[model samples]
Target: ATPSRPASGSASPARTSAKPARTSAAPEPARIPGPGYDSSADAQKQIEAALRAAKADGRAVLLDFGANWCGNCKAADKVFAQPQTAGILGASYHLVKIDIGGNSSANSALLRKYSPSGGTYTMPVLVVVSSSGTVRTDTHVTGNPSLTADGINAFLRKWAS
Candidate 1:
């Protein structure tokens, strides 16, 4: 089971301000934190719950596989938080973000089950599953496009069933 984490909602991108002037003192190590996703979650159970809910609501399940340390995953989260994409997601899909952790093996079984191309998966992979537990789209084969608002919105709209 993966650890419990923040609800799978779209998170706003980190805001960057002007850097503070360096002092004569030694510099501190940079620490960058990405979005919070449950690395210890029971992905199978989550998927089952989502599938049941989606079946009732005539919606699909969106499985987002990535690690919190992944830059591209963070960028994708920002796109998801945008109003246009968020609306579509809320209306049509049950979003589940599965954190792979640094080793990318947190949920290997789920990853392999949904992987369309092969066993290998890139970070921020997306798998769209129908309410009936059928895989509709696997980004492992299709490839995740640019993490732009328009691109994500279009993708969501296209596979929203």
Candidate 2:
């Protein structure tokens, strides 16, 4: 004789007999130590070097202004290091990370040469400079809150070769 079935709407005992599959724990996100933000370094000299490299490589210069203590800066660094953004940035620009000393007046004074109109004291400001050392005003990106993957990708695409 055939085995009896459970009620029409009920789950049969056989259906519940199988054990649940075990799932492994998800891996932790990588904590990449990005380009260091040096407070004591000469910012101008570093930018000059990057500019020279950019000129030689037929690319632009990307100045990353931020402090190591800024969480937003770190997040932006992560976005910049992503494969998509990194590939574009690597191919089109020479990158220079400059610590702004937490927006000190001295650092602001140094940054004024690139942003003469002011208002670039924000952390993680991205300044795109031509190989000739002219800051591309239209390419200046500020505010870490706006530094999402799409936003960064768009910015890179707009400025990259």
Candidate 3:
């Protein structure tokens, strides 16, 4: 006789097995530094250093512009630090965070160089630049909605290569 199906709401008997099912825990997300707007005159020096490193590594530069006080910026940082996203970023790009200050003028001149409007006017702006210092992804004019995990992953996938 065939075994009968369990009732709609009844609990099924637990089967005993010598070996337990193998399960692996998910990896912890990467933790990045909190945003702090840099106001030093040598900010450009720091950027140049990152660009050089990107060139040496044959990777692109991922410039993140925001202040520590911005909630959206913090959220974007967290999403970038997630394991899957971090791996892609770590392998393909050199990351740099530039604080644009509360008024968005802390690094206005430097920011204008990459922005289409030639202005440092947006918070949480992400710009991808090639090792040769050419802009790859310009988020200034059209704006990018990559603050969320899905959007960020898609953006990285599109530019990381």
TM-score of every prediction relative to native:
0.74, 0.68, 0.70
Q: Which candidate ranks first by TM-score, i.e. highest?
A: 1
User: Would you list the clashing residue pairs of candidate 3?
Assistant: none
Against the true structure, what is every candidate's RMSD?
A: 18.1, 13.3, 10.6
List the candidate 1 regions with Cα displacement exceeding 4 Å. 1-34, 102-106
Query: Could you tell me how far off, in angstroms, the CA of residue 110 lies in candidate 1 after the best superposition?
Result: 0.7
Give the candidate order by descending TM-score.
Answer: 1, 3, 2
List lDDT for all candidates, in order: 0.76, 0.68, 0.70
Tell me model 2's lDDT, rounded to 2 decimals.
0.68
Query: After superposition, which runs of candidate 3 have C-alpha atoms over 4 Å from their true positions?
Result: 1-41, 102-106
Model 3 TM-score on a 0 to 1 scale: 0.70
Candidate 1, overall lDDT? 0.76
Estimate candidate 1's RMSD in Å.
18.1
Location of the lowest summed lDDT over 10 successive residues in candidate 2 = 21-30
For candidate 1, give the lDDT of residue 126. Answer: 88
Best by lDDT: 1
| Candidate 2: Cα lDDT at 71 | 80
Task: Please give, for residues 66-147, the per-residue lDDT of candidate 3 as tens digits.
Answer: 7778888888888877877787777777777887764545466667777757654567888898989998887776587768
List residue ranges in candidate 2 displaced over 4 A.
1-36, 102-106, 138-145
